[model samples]
Target: MTGPRWIAAAWGQSSLRIWAMAGRKVLTEGASDQGVSRLGPRDFEPALLTLANDMLPLDEVTRVLICGQAGARKGWVEVPHAMVPCAPHAAPPVPAPSRDPRISVGILPGLGQTDPPDVMRGEETRIAGFLLDRASFDGVLCMPGLHGKWVRLRHGIVQGFRTMMTGEIYGLIARQSVLRPMMDDSWDEAAFRHAVDESTRHPETIVSSIFGIRASALLNTPAPGLARARLSGLMVGCDIGAMRTWWHNRPVAVLGTERVSTLYASALAAQGADVQALAGDRLTLAGLIAAHERTGHLEPSAAAHG
Candidate 1:
């Protein structure tokens, strides 16, 4: 491989992030709104080139290792999912058809489950990155996002996992449901904690509890901040309640430094679980670089030199 021979990309639904790399060190970085959701099959290469063309050399092909939705069924190239009870990077990178000879694109495969018919894209790469340094990690990984994932790992292999739609549900309730008028981004910590405690204790009443938010606004006109926090709490609490088997008394490392991650960490801490929050983006990049190295393209000596 030539110098600056690799590009690491994390392509999601709404945005695309890429890093030009000389081995493990990032040489330059770029991003755009041209996510997989907004482009057709033929548009992927061009969208990537628009951001990465300058990083390419004239004679050699620069390998682009991508994770996330770019490997979805409708993405740049539909990569298959690696079944669970396997290493996060169990499936090797699949080559995507590319036009420019200067660049070669390969996407990492996502993880899937059979019994429950569950599937995850992009997140598996993050899991791989998290386990890169923690080889003996024998616990659950709590990743909070629009589609939160609770992953169980033992002996460095993913045993099984579950997905929760807490964030998505919260978004719908806050923006599209009757509770919209009473919601805002401002958060009230006490209200959030109270809601979490209530919902975790009686998750079956969530439907009615949600309605109570609207009713409370109608009668008492609670601050929008409080209402929003309460709504988030209800959704996250329900998830925590259902995932007790995975998290109870376990060492859980929550991914992301975002507000959602904080909420999960707080809720898990309250439940008396050992918890720690990790930086999401850093791990994501590490996973991409790890995949790149595992593919046998970037040599260890080359990385050391860079």
Candidate 2:
């Protein structure tokens, strides 16, 4: 695709973000064709290089703010690991480029301290921006994905979070595990609820329960829909069970696609908790725009147009 006249780029493992601004107005904003599962260092090079290349010819373009996971190490920003939960906020240092000049880059750090740290990459920075002045809730914020995050937020900062390999596990089991042979590709809500109920009741048996789909099919269980529901139940149930302590009595705000958020809502509601799902797109955009505003990259004229 041809580059836009002006652009703000944010890169991640799953997608490349571009916000193209013209004059004071954002003409368009969207992601690249590539998805995170297919992302690697090589894929990111072309994506960023292409944006930089495109920016060279657009004299109207004045600023480029790049942040996210893709900007770390092999790309733009670097930082030493820290052990504190809420480290002092620091802006990403200006990168010394290899050759590209059309794009100016900034990198943001992740949350936490450890090897397997909870890094925000691009979206975290944006989320930070969106969270400005939002009152802190002693609750959980669910960000769903291939690597879904169940975060504990206290007083407007992230205290701790656990990553659930729900999406990846679902993909693996649905395609390669024995469950694939007995399950249909379509969704069955009733069956899904049934599975949810069952998993909730017997949360400890999640692993074996996941494999039960194959056994049920082999044993001549009447409904393919039930089998599918069972699969869904196992994952959601296990997640709920694992997070029971973390989420107990806390309001849950899910941040992601409605479907995933709904599943989380259902699981939470079943346990008698107040839960809500926020629009993923809006939150992401708000977060990014907020970051720009915080850094003074977004001037009054830009704010008026935006």
Candidate 3:
């Protein structure tokens, strides 16, 4: 029971989540709003210690394995991206200089593609975790978030991937564009599906079609909910249209929280693609654990020495 305890961190854009662990068993967990976006290089260590310092032992160093934006050029320490056609965790974890000797931090690298020119940080970890138990899986993983990623995998290697700004575009239009007036928290399932069909079938009309939402408001008083749903569908559908090769008549896994994944699943389903939705947290943990194991920094023997 006295074995050395380690830390696992998923430092994202807007939040920092960590688990104090002994091997695969978590002893404690903590979270913070000090996401990578909100901190400077100097602030990364302080932000981590604020949440994990209490979990550290008095005389020995505790190893910390981190994934996500903390490795971005602007984050704690910029780790290089592992070129794709490679393993999900292909890039090694890079160490960050720490002011405190009690803790050692390593940020895992993200994945990058050359031909189409794409990159990802945290999602790579989730992909690794998902594949850990299903090494034979050969398909696409559609991860929806601020920036949605459609990744191609075969024989446990990340063949290539693409990124879409669907979520970010939605946020921008909802908050800043002329479409702002029709945006709200409500949704219309029928309207959403109709919009998806329209976009998927005729993607070229997307640019012109977006203006119709505002025009509809000026002419006929459609509910704000309908307009919002229609907008989301149009955006998501456009993304799907671009990545047809990845999902058309192929097995696809949609990885994300229920809310986000449901929207993507609905869109993919309408296109006649075989899709399965999965929750992402456990997979993220698995990926981080796998990264930790690969480092050998917290192995039973290593921990005992610490």
Best by lDDT: 3
Tens digits of per-residue lDDT for model 1, 97-161: 98887877789999999978888888898998999999899999999888889999987799999
Who wins the TM-score comparison?
A: 3
lDDT ranking of the models: 3, 1, 2
TM-score, each model?
Answer: 0.94, 0.81, 0.95
Clashing residue pairs in candidate 3 are: none
- Which stretches of model 3 miss by more than 4 angstroms? 1-4, 297-306
lDDT of each: 0.87, 0.62, 0.88
Task: Write the residue-wise lDDT of candidate 3 on 214-284 in tens digits.
Answer: 99889997785898899888988888887887788779999998998999998998899899999898899
The residue ranges of model 2 lying beyond 4 angstroms of the native Cα positions read 1-6, 22-25, 35-45, 49-57, 72-84, 87-98, 115-123, 296-306
Of 1 and 2, the candidate ahead on TM-score is: 1
Query: Candidate 1's error at 171, in angstroms?
Result: 0.9
The residue-by-residue lDDT of candidate 2 on 205-229, one tens digit each, is 8888876677767788547467766
